[model samples]
Target: MPRLRANDIEQDKIARFERIKKAITALEKQQKQILKQGDLAPEGAWVARYQVSQNRKKYWYYKLQVPTPSLPCATSSKLSKYKHLGKAGTQEHIDAVMSVFRRSVWDEIQRIIHTLDDCLLDISSGSEQEEEEAQD
Candidate 1:
């Protein structure tokens, strides 16, 4: 097996750091566009539900992606935090769907950016440590 040299390792780290920085910049731009599109809409998912009772009723609701804090004495399930959108064919319903989609896309972009940021930090710190060792 061929052993890797210290110079080869340093080059690899620099390459990785550059790639991560590029990815983070792209993700930040996408996030900004998504935010601009969703500026007027509240972030949540549009949900449709059915009931066995009341003549098999169908309902539409908007459930927040992140649940809000509840009162100390409140005995509510996570599922109970939905806000009724009422009637799925309305313009409001369409807007709600768009809002949900925008929020989901934004969240995914943010997640990628965060993970890349961590990797970039790790690579930066590793390079710094190597430099210090080389100076000793």
Candidate 2:
């Protein structure tokens, strides 16, 4: 069997770490949006999609469309509709939902990080042993 170089293993581990970090950041942003606007409002926000092409490479991006009152003239109807908007439910309910979503994502990230840590430790230990054998 061929022995793996320490640098090679470390580079792979670092790349995995960076990818996990990016996922965590994205999740956190989603969680914040839910918390700030209340679950229903943000859920109803329209999604705008666009594609950009540069140097033969294409990338897609999405942004939330701001919601405006559909019945601008019906002041009473508008008030009644949005009356339950922020006051639809208790803060506890919103927090509970966000908590569940955040926890599940966080747990997955933690599991991946733990697995990568073990792999890094094993690689370091193996490299140390190899160095000792080379010296002997």
Candidate 3:
């Protein structure tokens, strides 16, 4: 078998990279639109406010409360700290706390899915290109 030329390998690599980059850009744009839609959170779901201490500092956290049969009560699980107030019920308040939480959740899911989709697209494209070249 003959060895591959340096120029041929470089060109192949460049083509693969461009294909991967384009797929990633498209996936990122789609993910942004998904997050922007903001339909992840269910309508009329109650969000609770609570205070959690971290590193001896009090911080305000919010969580979505879903009524359950076993619990029969709204249980608050810590989600994220308010951007302004360090603790719950602090003087520094944030407007539309529920909206903030919903947005954060949407953004996080979008980011994770975007990364996975980009990686899969890159690998599949690269493999297909390699196979096509091998057959030639």
Which structure among the candidates has the greatest lDDT?
A: 1
Against the true structure, candidate 1 reaches a TM-score of 0.62
Alpha-carbon local distance difference test for all models: 0.65, 0.50, 0.55
TM-score of each: 0.62, 0.31, 0.34
Tell me the tens digit of each residue's lDDT in model 1 across 1-136: 8988999988999898998899889899988888788542344444454333356765444333225432122344544445545465666566666777887788889889888888888887874455444563
RMSD of 1: 7.6
Candidate maximizing TM-score: 1
Poorest stretch of ten by lDDT in candidate 3: 78-87
Off by over 4 Å in 2: 1-89, 127-136
Error of 2 at 122 (Å): 1.6
Candidate 3 matches the true fold with a TM-score of 0.34
- Candidate 1 achieves a global lDDT of 0.65
Tens digit per residue, CA lDDT, model 3, 9-119 = 778767766776776677677657756754443433345677777999986675544444222222355432222233344433232344546656656656776775666
lDDT agreement of model 2 with the native: 0.50
Model 2 lDDT tens row, 55-104: 99986654333355431233453422121212224564354345445555
Q: Residue 55 in candidate 1 has what lDDT? A: 61
